[model samples]
Target: MDTRNKKRLGAMLLTGIVSLSAIASGCGNNAADDANAGANEQPANAATENAVAGAGMKDGKYDPPITITYLRPWGPDVKFKDGENQDNNVHAKWASEKLGIELKNQWISPSTNNAFETKLRLSLATNEPMPDIISYRGDFNLVRELIDSGRFVDAGELFDKYASETWKKAMDEDPSVWYPYMQDGKRIGIPILDYAYNGDPVMWIREDWMKKLGLSAPKTLDDLEKVMDAFANQDPDGNGKKDTYGLAIGFKNWINTWMSDAGWIFGAFGTMSNQWNLSADGKLEYGSVTPGAKQALATLQDWMGKGYLPTEAGLYDETKAAEDFTAGKAGIVVGPHWMPAWPLEDVKKNNKDAQYKAYPVPSGPNGQAGRHGTSNANGVVLINKDMAHPEAFFTYQNYLFDQFANPPIGGEFEYGLAEGYDWVMVDGKPTTDAAHTGGFAPEKYTITFDGARIPGLNMATLAKLADGGEAATPFEKKLKLSTPQTMLDAAKIVLEQKDITMQQLFTGAPTATMQMNNDILAKMEKDTFSQIIYGKAPIDSFDAFVEKWKASGGDQITREVNEWYQSVSGGQ
Candidate 1:
């Protein structure tokens, strides 16, 4: 990347290096005040005092606990134990007693789209004092703007100083993972990592329905079509009501999603929607504009005409579309391995005879199958420049990685995060099921913390077990105990077909042109595709849409995307 582009990309992608303010909070003896107390000293001496004040004594615990303020987005589903709230959760108590750190919430917003963003924008516009730490699962552009405002700290130095080797290794799985959180060669934001294969899309079909129809699981696109035809027309449910659909999918928004996602169908044709993929010529090209995408759209149109797809699919969102599947009115749905925990599991609740199994997406005519890949890093942790102790944050975080994520042998967290909360002793053996959580139900009512995960832990464990190995670690054991056999089987299929996973080639922020005109182009694509599938527009309308896309800002976006791709790939 060019020097200026590097800086631009850094600032655009992540937060920035920051200088701390020498301000004291409720504490009569804060590091910030301690540093300023020696103001008559030399410049070099003052610099030393400032650094010490920002970090505090690194003796594993503070004599007097220091408080760290933060903001949280509370979800509607959020619950608390009988006597426990966000301010007094098990995790908070652990931190206070073990690390001598206090957590204080500045304010919490409902965890809905635009809720936190709205509050955060107002706070930023007013130039209100930021909390000690702020974490967001999304809104990268907002974080970028905040980084530009120079209110956050450069976490690079602090991480280098305090992050344990285990934590560092977790981040090192892919060094480029840090690029999204870097600014001017400084890692300004800490990435909250997730499993790499969590987003791997799979086909979930009703096993009982397949057997009732005497159809085997599909391995090819033709076989899949045959199965869908049987499912839609043969009344596999045996309820004597022509009510079932062959497939359930939604297109109210983008085709790509975690539940009932249509990305794999496009992938079967060697393309995916809402992303850029490397073309045969080795250039990043928009997936939706490709000929393969048009062919996929045509297939979907045929499916709809044949009554293989739910009639109201266009009106449903991801989860809403799966209601038919849960109600046993649809036999097939596509989603991630975790679908068993959601709408699929609800199938058994509604109909005890419903037996669903997951399979790899059936191969296309070209003898290939594909699914969209997931980005490992999901959210970022931002710290305020005026915060007294970045090291304390690192301390708490590293402990989470080491103990909670990858606990050493004979560690306290081997069974679960907290006994009687996440797990309880049943017959003198630890169990993670909700049956044992008493009334606490820690999983549903998380009080301690949010937004941190060990990248690749769950997938790695499942892969190992799929290969005929026993759970070797506590984390693996917990996962093995909790996840269903169907999901594990699906994970094996996903792992076996890993080579077919397609990922977005461009990971940079939206270019100026894209930010300006991408929404218009997206609307055009959705409307054109939906219209064609519904028989409202000629298939040739795809060509018109393509031309319009290119004539708009798409060409500029493509050029900028290629520039970013080349920069990241060392000008390859």
Candidate 2:
């Protein structure tokens, strides 16, 4: 389960601002008398003055409790205990009792049907008082709008000052995480971190079919074609229907989408369609128009002509394409390491003999292999410029990263949040079964959504286990007990080929040209690619499409993207 958007905290609180003014009374006192009175009172007021000066923070707790306000999207997935709600939950109580900080929601809107975004835009247009914090995970254009509104503070300095060493090290693992939230050489939003390489593609092949057909694992493009031919032409299923296809892919929306991805095909030829890749000359280049894409398209056209793909592939989306493989109609599909836990598991229910195994993606003719890389950060946390206690947010987050993220042995959250909620005593041992624990997930009440995570920790733990290391740590033991051996092997393969993963280089907000013409250009690119694969157009049409793409604002878009990259990277 990605659960990226589901792990978010939403609420708001209003802070009271007090203004103090001194009133001068005409007592006809001379300057000398007034000076004497001040000198006499200085000694007496010293202790009170120091207390007032240190009110903001004292021993990691606010002296005068401060309230932090936020706005977030809510969904039915967010549940509450009998007496606890979003604003008065266990997390909120901990903040108040332990940290002397109050967590409050300015307002909340349903996450469904863009209600949150619509209401946020209305607030922006009406110039409403911005909350102290805003946690957003939706459209990038809206994030850009929030930044352009000039109501949020530059978080770079605050992050440097208040962020814990653990938090800083986790963020340093991927500096590009800040690119999307950056503007005018300053970080306007704090990135909400998630696990690394969670979505990187690995080929999953039907092991039963491969063994029955007497075929080996595909190591190269030529080897892959032979396997595809065997899967499509050879009666691997032995049903004598001649209905099975070689590969399962979805191209209706995006070739590089989450499930039934086709990006690895283009990646084998040295380009990824619908992404921005770093060119040899240190510029951002659109992948769809690159020369390698033409070769990839020709190959897909050949595959389609040989009935290696579903005939309705052009109409299937990511989920629909995955259904083809899960329904036992296709032999191989490409997806993340977690596929075994999901749609692939259904293959077993449908056919007891069905067995799938993950494999490394095959290399191209030149021995170069590539696939899409996942971003570690999912959303951004924006700080209000008018916020009084900015460091308080960091204090709250630092505790989560240090203690709760990868909990220490025998720590408060080692088993789960709230024993009776997410975990319960089953014969003197903790168990997370809902039947025993009452089906509660108290960690969801956290302000940062799913809580803090070190981006590289999860994969590193899995790799260690894959390498035959002992599960010594709490986190490692937990994973070893829960994760399947097949996923561990997949994680090892994914880490082994980490060098070949190509991340989209342009992570900033959409450029002016992109904002204006991106829809038309995206539709044109998808249509052209789909048509070429279906053999409705000649291979040479790709060349004409490239020329038209460059002429139709792509050239300007490329320039703007590179300029933004340079601004963020300082030209490296």
Best TM-score among the predictions, by candidate number? 2
Residue-level error in angstroms, candidate 1, position 467: 4.7
Q: Name the regions of candidate 2 deviating beyond 4 angstroms.
A: 1-53, 56-59
Candidate 1 TM-score versus the reference: 0.85
Q: Could you estimate the TM-score for every candidate?
A: 0.85, 0.89
Give the per-residue lDDT digits (tens) of candidate 1, residues 1-572.
Answer: 22113222222222111000000011111211222222112121122223444445345565578788887566554556767776788767877887678877788787566798899989999999999888765566776777777888887777766666556656666455655666665778777665556657789999998888899889988899999999989988887888888988987866766567788888889998878898888899999999988988888889999999988878987778888899888899987666676657789888897899988898889987888876556567888899877666776666666566545435767776678776788898877666667534343222222323545455655655555667656655666676667766776676667778887667666678888997798789889989988878878888989999999988889998887766656544
Name the runs in model 1 displaced over 4 angstroms: 1-59, 112-115, 182-186, 439-451, 566-572
Pairs of colliding residues, candidate 2: 11-105, 12-104, 12-105, 12-106, 13-104, 13-105, 13-106
Q: What is the C-alpha lDDT of each candidate?
A: 0.69, 0.76
lDDT of 1 at 301: 88
**Model 1 RMSD vs true structure:** 10.8
TM-score of 2: 0.89
